[model samples]
Target: MRVGPVGVLVRPRAGVAGLVVAVALLGVAGVAVFSGSLDIAPARVLAALAGDGTRVETLVVVDRRLARTLAAVLVGFALGCAGALTQSITRNPIASPDILGVTTGAGFFAVLLITHPALLPGGSAMLAAAAITGGLVTTGGILALSWRAGFDGLRLILVGISVNAIGMAGVSWLLLRTDIDQAAVAMRWLTGSLSGARMPDVLLLAPFVLAAGLACAYLARDLAALRLGRSVAPALGTAPGRTEALALLVAVVLASGATAVAGPVAFAAFVAPQAAMRLFGTAGPPPLAGGLTGALLILAADLTAQRLPAELPVGVVTAVVGAPFLLYLLHRHRRRTSV
Candidate 1:
C-alpha cells in the first residue's frame, strides 16, 4: 500500500503474522502467570482473570502474577514502539533506546535518585521525571554531536557509545558511594526485574504510553515521507525537522516510561523491531508487529527465568538471548555495507 508520496509495500501476510504473534503472546502470558513456582492451574487462572476464582487463586493470579504480567506487557509494548521509532528516525536497523544511550541515561538518573533519595523528593513521579529528562538530554547531545550537514547514523551510534560509557561510569560511582545493600538493590534494578511490580506503577505509566502510541499513529504518514529522504520529504509536504523532532519526542516518552517501571530491559528495544521486520518481510518498521513481538519475548523470557533451577533477572535472560542476535546483526550489516 502507498502512503504519502512514498510507496510503502504493506505485505498482506504481515497482518496475519501479527495476529498469530498476539495470540502466541497471550498463551505465553497465561503460562507465565499460572505455571510459576506456585503452579496455579490454567482453569483457575482463567477464572481469576474473569473475577470468579477462590481467594487463594485470586491472590496468586490476580494480586501478584497479574500485576507483574501486565507490567511486562505494557513495558514491552512501550520499548518495542520506542525502538521502531528510533530506528526509523535514525534510518538504522540497530538504533535502539538502549544502544543510543537513552536507556542508559534514564537508568543513570533513576539510579542517582535511588542511591540518594535526599537528592530529590522520593516518589515514582520524581523518578519518572528524572528518567525522561536524562533521556531527552542524552538524545539531544547525540543529535548535536552527529549533525554536521545532517544527521548521520554512524556518528550518532558512536556518540551514543561515548555517552553510554559516561553514564555507566556515573552509575558505577554512585554504586561505590552507596552502602552494600543499597548498591545490591540498585544493581538488581539496573538488570531489570518484574518482581514486586505493582499495579499503581502500571497505572501511572499507562497514560504516557497511550498518548505516545496515539501520537505515533498520527505521525505514521509523515514518517513514511521522511523515510524517502530529506529532499523528498519536504517535496512530499512533510517538514522533516518537525516530523523528526516529534517522532523523537514520542520515542523518548515511551522509552522513559518503560525504563521508569522496568529498568533498561537490556535488548528488548533492539530486538523487537528487527524481529518484526523479519517476520513481516518489510523494509520499514512494523510498529504493531514489533510491539507484539516485544511483549511475547518479555513474557517468554520472564517465564523461562522463573522456571529455571535458579530464577534469574529478566534482563540477564534477554542479554543472553539478544547478545548473540546482536552479533549476527552486526555481521550481516557489515557484510551488506562491504558488498
Candidate 2:
C-alpha cells in the first residue's frame, strides 16, 4: 500500500509554506557562515564544498566543520522521524525518545565503553552497537510497563519520566566513578558534540537510518489507525499491539543510530514532529515532513553554534533552543485541558 499523508483540509497554501521553511533554513545557514563567525569566505565555503579549495579551508571548513554539520542533520532527521512514529503509536503528544530515557540509556552504555578500557570492545562501532542495545532494552522496559497497565497514555508518560530519572542517575554514577581523562572524553560525548564526525561513522549510520525510515513510512497507515484508541483500532483491521511494537522498533533503531552518529543530541525528537504537526494542522505526524524539519533545525542550529564566539556543542545549543518551546507546549496543553 502506498501510504500517503493524512489530509485535514487546511489552507491551500500550507503545503507551499512547508517548502518555504527549507529555504529559510538555508538563508540562516548562509548568514551564519558569512557573518565572520567562521573564517571561511562564501567563495571558500563554495570551493571546499565543490572539492577544490585551499588546504586550510579544505581541512578546517570542509572536513572538520561541514562533516560535523552533516552529521547533525542526519542524526536530527533520524531522531525526529523516530519521535513522530513513537508519538503516533502511543497517541501521546509528549512522547519522545529523550523523555522516555531511551537516548540517555544509549549514552550511558556508550560512556561505559569510553570510560573503561576493560569493558568489551572500544571502537566507535562497538560503542554504537552497545548504544543501540541499550536503547532497545530501555524501550522494551517502557513498553512492558505500559502494557501491564493496559497501555494508558498518562501511565506511559509517568513511567518514562521515572525511567529518565533512573537513567540520569546511572550517567552521573559513571561520571563520578571513572578516571578524569576518561570522564572528560565521556563528558564531551554526553554533551553531544558534532566535533569530529568522520566519514566511516556517517556510512555506518546511513543504511540503518534508511531502513528504519522506510519501515516507519510503511507503518504510517496503521499508525493513523492507532490514534483511535486500542479497542477501536482492532475493528479497523489493525492489531494495535503489533503495530505499536513495530513502530517502537523503528523508533528505537532510529534513536540508537542517531545517538551513535551524533551522541544524544537533545530535543531533536520532541521539537521536530511538534513543529511539523503545528505547521500541517491536525494531521498525524508527517514522517517525511518531520525528517525534513529535523534536518533543517539541526543544520541551522549547528551553523549558529559554529559561528558563536564560544562554539558550544550543537546539542547544547539545541537544548537551549528547544526548552522554551517545550515549556510553551506544556503550558498550552495544561490550559486547554483545564478549560
Best candidate per TM-score, number? 1
Which regions of candidate 2 are displaced past 4 Å? Answer: 1-14, 25-38, 41-44
lDDT of 1 by residue, 256-336 (tens): 888888888999999988988898776677565677788888888877877789888889888988899999999998999
| Residue 144, model 2, lDDT | 78
Residue 6: error of model 2 in Å? 15
Error of 1 at 246 (Å): 1.0
Off by over 4 Å in 1: 1-10, 52-56
Q: What is the Cα-based TM-score of model 1?
A: 0.92
The C-alpha TM-scores of every prediction are 0.92, 0.88
RMSD of each: 3.0, 3.2
Tell me which residue pairs clash in candidate 2: none
